[model samples]
Target: MPTPSYPPKPSPGDRIAVVSPSSGLPGLFPRPYELGLARLREEFGLEPVEYPATRRMGATPQERADDLHAAFADPEVKAVVASIGGDDQITVLPLLDRELLRSCPKPFFGWSDNTNLLAFLYDCGVVGYHGGSVMCELGRPGAMHPMTAESLRAALFTSGPYELRPAERWNDVDRDWADPATFESEPRSRPGGGWSWINADRVVEGRSWGGNLEILSWLLMADRAIARDESAYDGGVLILETSEELPGATEVFRILRCMGERGLLRRFPALLTARAKSWSFERPNNPQQAARYAADQRAAVERALRAYAPDTMAVFDVDFGHTDPQLVIPYGGTVRVDGPARRITVTY
Candidate 1:
């Protein structure tokens, strides 16, 4: 793989594309979408430009690809942001015009299903951001989390190393977007105990890789953007997080085991696992249940690593992925994991 470079960052007045490369939850939940757009303009001072398929749910794969092409190919659009995530973005991968995106690269920010595009862009030799979806982060109910806002501000306009910090208070429970009352207050959170490190004897710095665990499994099964040469990931820091779907512990272990079988797990010297999302409307477990859920997931990860990459350094409960107060992780960009100092930094 060629060295991936960061795309030019967007300026305050620049027009940034807001496309739903996955799902158009914007149409259904206009409250958060509009709030997010307002924050983009008022708080971030950037103009958000939406495409035709952005608000149209069930848009075909070709239509989504066209929007991606238009956004990346347009010189006026300095960046691309996803409105929200969906389940089937993998379908749009093959339809994408790699040459077009490669020739006209721009910073793209999103997570979850957007992992597909971020992975694709990384393969195209362009670094893409792996957090800050419009509806979820920017449109967060009440005020944006202070840590999240500060981190995003630095990422959007700055070009230097920014350290990642654990949220003082973090939340995994989500409010009902369908209820207007949900937007009336901030999501409740509990005190964060900070990151837990495993095998923190040395520092590791390398290009970052990985995203939503479930989506990556899909990509691996389809033989998509993952590098054909296992050596491509040598020395890279692996980032993994589960989604709102909350796959079982056994499933998570099985997925990583498969990656290890393919010789992909042992290459990374360090790993950063996003704080596990423990709550969802479909399976709303109580506090005790949620705690057990997270513990089980962590145990599952440890089991897989013991069987494969036992030497790798692992950090758990870093604030990113499906949790509130998400941090923007650069896909294919350089990351510095200082285990001895207990610090993590990424270049934008």
Candidate 2:
């Protein structure tokens, strides 16, 4: 596979394509979507161009692919950003025009279900930005977290090495987007206890890989995105994080087991796992329940490591994925995981 390269950065006044390759949550919840667009203009000084499917719910894979094609092929569209993430983005992957996308590479920014698109861009030799969604970040209630805003700004406009700092305060809890009152204040967060490290005796630096754990499991099952030979991922930093669906600890272990069995688990010399999102509207976990869930998830990860990548260094809760105050990671870009200094940096 060809090495992924960073696409050209968009200037402040350039246009950005706000395409919905996934679900059109923006149509259902226009409050946040509109706010996000406003911020893109006011704060970032970039014009957001919405595609036909951008606000259409129940858009088919073909429709989504068309939007993506138009977005990337348009010279005026400097970058492409997802309105929000959804479950079926994987279905749209097969419909994408690889040659077109390869010829007109753009920096794509999104996380969660949009991992599908990022994975596709990786194979196209383009570096994508993970963890900068419209509804979630730009439309954040009250205001964008200082750290998140800063990290995103750096990722979007700059091309250099950026050091990632652990969030001083972090959260996975969210309020109802439909409720008008939910926009009145920032989501609650707890004081961060620094990231937990296992086997922090060595430094690992290489191109980064991995995404939402559940999405990756699905990709592996569908024979999508992941390289044909696991060695394509060797030496790369592995990033894994769970979503708000809150899959059980047993499920998490099983997924890793499958990857390990496929010889994919030991490719990475280092792993950076996000803080688990234990609380969701479906299951509103209390403080104690949240703690137990986190513990179990971490333990499951450790168990998988012991069984398959015992020598891999891991750091948990480095402030990305499914969490508030997220930091943008450059997908397929260079990552430096320095265990001795407990510092993680990414090249944007």
Candidate 1 error regions (>4 Å): none
Q: What is the per-residue lDDT of model 2 for residues 241-310, given as tens digits with 9 covering 90 to 100?
A: 9999999999999999998999888999999999888899999999999999999999999999999999
Estimate the lDDT of model 2: 0.92
The sequence of per-residue lDDT tens digits that candidate 1 reaches over residues 1-348 is 667898889889999999999998999999999999999999999999999999999899999999999999889999999999999999999999988988998999999999999999988899989898899999999988888888888888999999998888999999889999999999999988799999999999999999999999999999999887769889999999999999999999999999899888899999999999999999899989999999999999999999999999999999988998899888999999999999999998
Once fitted onto the true fold, the runs of candidate 2 whose alpha carbons sit more than 4 angstroms away are none
Tell me the alpha-carbon RMSD of every candidate.
0.7, 0.7
Q: Report residue 60 deviation for candidate 1 (angstroms).
A: 0.3
lDDT of 2 at 85: 95
